[model samples]
Target: MTGQEENGATRKGPTRALVLHPDLKSERRRRAPELALAEAVSLAAALADLAVTGAEVVRLARPQPGMLFGAGKIEELKARIEADEVELVLIDGPVTPVQQRNLEREWKVKLLDRTGLILEIFADRAHTREGVLQVELAALSYQRTRLVRAWTHLERQRGGLGFVGGPGETQIEADRRAIDEEVVKIRRQLAKVVRTRELHRAARRKVPFPIVALVGYTNAGKSTLFNRMTGAEVLAKDMLFATLDPTMRGVLLPSGKKVILSDTVGFISDLPTQLVAAFRATLEEVLEADLILHVRDIAHPETEEQAADVREILESLGVEEEVPVFEVWNKIDLLTLEQRAALLVQDARTPGIHTVSALSGEGLEALLDAISTALDDRRTIETLTLGFEEGRARAWLHEQGVVKAERDGDEGHEMTVALTERQRAQLERLRQG
Candidate 1:
């Protein structure tokens, strides 16, 4: 996927994209190094649609107080951009407003950092009203911070007074003000959306279906696995961040009990703060899930690192509650027999782990049975006898779980029921009278 661009290389749209890898050495050395590499790869895949020719990695000696990268690197990058005729410069790191403006002036091309590119992808992928609002809010927050960058909005109105307005009230400032206003408006709109979603969740709460959320590193085939599990086409692809919106579908497990499975946006190491703020609504799906299926690509070299990154992100979001997590080592079809056995043995040592190839439908029935058993284990089974007059409890028991046996004796209709711990407790309280 790497190449060199030719001079006067015209394309139907933009062809050449200059990618710069800015390593936050201090951060990586302190927190995690493998995650940094995963971020770089995810950024490359995010910009895959831009016809990227090649990428350069700028390993910073030390963090510059003003700009992240040094002046010498910037000069060399400018020369490289001109020589390659790159139209779009994608920085695989965060760029400040002043640094972004300076880079554009020095390189003389369209400059975008990791946060900006993720927002752009979200803007394209968002479909629902809430998702669109969240994206807009995040975009405005990001743009408001980086107001010095040159774009179509800046060229319109420069500095002026009287007819135009004050120099402070120029186009950029005005746009910032408008974005601020829009942010507030979008927040209000999202509040409504949140209320609507809460209502839907409350309705689902009445049902006894256990919820499972599919989570993994970006481009780890989460949506593909989701499609295979629920038979729902929710934008499966080989690119990073392919699925932005959350999709939920019901899956009937082997136990004949219906369970809900949700496909969510993939996680990436060092995901932008603006994006985290914007996609909170979507991530809420994972938080509310009854079980989490942490799908991983066993064939990937950095699979363990990716798993650590996913765990870190989940812990940060406070979803590390005792909700059972099943480690599903996916993409086993691509692995060799030795690799598969090794992974299986390793997974066996870890509690509640399984191996499956979602694409080839191998070892899926076992996975389903595992899910069913996990769901059933979470419930407290109770043996109960119901009178004939309590038809409502009998119906509730049938709806919730299995009704083992019933006898219509001389006194009334006696029934034995198996239900969840909560349901059993509630029935016990009812039968006490």
Candidate 2:
């Protein structure tokens, strides 16, 4: 029922939230604090039915170990929380166990740091089996560190444990042993899923189409662009982590080459090291991709930082440096006429950069052509001779549609074929095996 009220507006009762971002005043910050605070509010809203009642950027010259915010700010915010009847307070940075507990006690409300809020969003969005397992595992890892607080007598505190309950429970299902057991169980199940996925990947290797992966920070229009290109109805919402499961669609590029386009889970800054460790199966899609498209919301103020976060996650996943990647500047339709021209000039000056608005289908032709070129760049024509006994190689060539001409010569069948370096390797492996 959307948790709506009688006036047809969002109900701000228990779901009411105050988004507080502790902006560390640093010269090395990549984005403005206002932009960070706004992103925090967006993230809070992305969680399960959280209606942001208020938001603020709290400048922190230095972090407090016991309580994140000062006593004065805590008391003041407590009054606001009480006046507004806010049920949740989401801090847009890491909060130690002691800090979270103290703040929660002071505010008389639940609290979640950046990682906890993201984990909640992930858990809510995870639908596929592997995705569900990954989310649980990540949440368990986050929960392990947060088993207790300042009030050690309480054992496990309710705040900062990410989402609460299963199908329906009011408080976070937590504790050390519960989290440990859940983590182990999830790992076993995920291992099975990972093996199955490997078999699927092996089967995909037998197919000829190259795999192109779309990766970027959350809500950077990756799924939208994937839908625009592949005509697949993926859940392309304006919310964070809208697409949790990795989705693949067969896309025919402008060059008429069929390729598998994969839309993966979005990356975010400080994306929970546990998530990075647990979601390797989904990240492997990026590793196996013949080309990676770093989609960016060009209209966002933190576009550069978002792109950097995606790159960092990719690197952490051990994505090879040799993989050809294209910087796809998405949402150009949101730009002004002058801004679009500037973007075009910037894109033209870069070798692997393209600008496109996935929503409007603008500059898509050029983007498609770029995809074709990047995939085709690894191709080379070569002549190979296969005996009648080597019908498998001959059939594989025909399957790949890379054979330009084939004729039965005296000694054997000689044919000229065009294929990528990876394709050449695949052919060699087939011949050797």
Candidate 3:
């Protein structure tokens, strides 16, 4: 709610964003070169939407140990900030404590890098208690490094971390220790959250519903597709990182079998290390899924590249090719007739390929059918032979499996049961007894 009056007219906010692109050649590159710039731009805009009034972009010189950008570029940016009365400068790449402090001093504005911007976004978006805890853990983990530009009234501890000087706590060492203590507290709380989630997962396993995780590049229409499929309104937006947390709901297939559909946080090339680690609990939903629906924005210029990036992330997450996958070429409505026809033909030959417009609900029935068929194929049929003496087992078979027929005999009775593998195993154990 930082605001400034504009010519005594409507009040305006104080935030000013400076979007940056890290030189790919630098050892400090934050993400893949192809996605880094575009992601940075998207994040900057999203940040501005979070109460920032004005925004601008700057290309930083390749990472130098001492300075983030070259001296010449710094001078030019400083002038702009001064003239525009900029209150904040947002860098698209990671900035070391030294770099952040130096930039703030030179530019005379609050400076934040890609990590800070993302952390800020999470801080703003997190509503649930668990979600807030995760975001706080990440923010604290990040802030433990860079702590400069203490607002005018904010105290720098007298005996704490050198970054913050609070009354009677100036020692930077003490501040670091305090921050470390808080980090431990947050971690413990998040660990509890993870355990709670694990219990929920166990409950789901007992019900034995197949899980299909919707995964793709950020802003690749994953949320849109998820809402279309599950009819949940979990924030579908055209902005990057619109959906941070993973969302799960029951999706009934055309055959009337129920499956769990989890819309997970979208993958972005060069995703921040801190974020990946902090959000591991949420992402593991993908790992446990029975199938992965890789929804892609087919019309994006970097669609293929984005797909590769998502694959890399999946690999890192241990979601290997062994898990069933279906590729959903989304946003078909955005394509021209010629391009759409070409993609339709090309994707047709690709296994598990389907086209759909999540926004417009186009071709969704086909996708659902494909999912139902995939689930059916995963179901293994087990044959069972039961003796009449085992009447209890026979009765259980009737409850759990589809019985074909019954043959009666003087000694006992036998029945053929088409049951699932688990049911068959149980029945076999019963027969042996």
- Model number with the top lDDT: 2
Mind giving the per-residue lDDT tens digits that candidate 3 earns over 1-433?
2343468874554355555565645365434555566667677665433333344444544566677778888888788777866666767767888888788778866666777777766655566567778777776677666544332112422111212111222346665677688889878888888889878776665566677899998889999988888888899889877887778899899899888999877787667777777777778878777788999999988888889988988888776455778999999999999999998898778879999999999889988988998877765644445556689877765654356677876666656644443345556677778
The segments of candidate 3 whose C-alpha lies over 4 angstroms from its true place after superposition are: 4-14, 24-35, 48-61, 147-171, 382-433
Best by TM-score: 2
Question: lDDT score of model 3?
Answer: 0.71
Query: CA lDDT of each candidate?
Result: 0.73, 0.80, 0.71
Candidate 2: misplaced stretches above 4 Å?
1-14, 149-174, 382-433
> How far is 302's C-alpha from truth in model 2 (Å)?
2.0
Predicted candidate 2 versus true structure: per-residue lDDT over 35-103, tens digit per residue: 888888888877755678999988877787789777788788889999998877888888887787778
TM-score of each candidate structure, all chains considered together: 0.80, 0.83, 0.79
For each of the candidates, the C-alpha root-mean-square deviation to the true structure, in angstroms, is: 7.5, 5.8, 7.1
Candidate 1, residue 41: CA error in Å?
A: 5.1
Model 1 C-alpha lDDT per residue in residues 85-130, reported as the tens digit of each score = 8777777777777877666667767677777777766766778888
Q: Is candidate 2 or candidate 3 better by TM-score?
A: 2
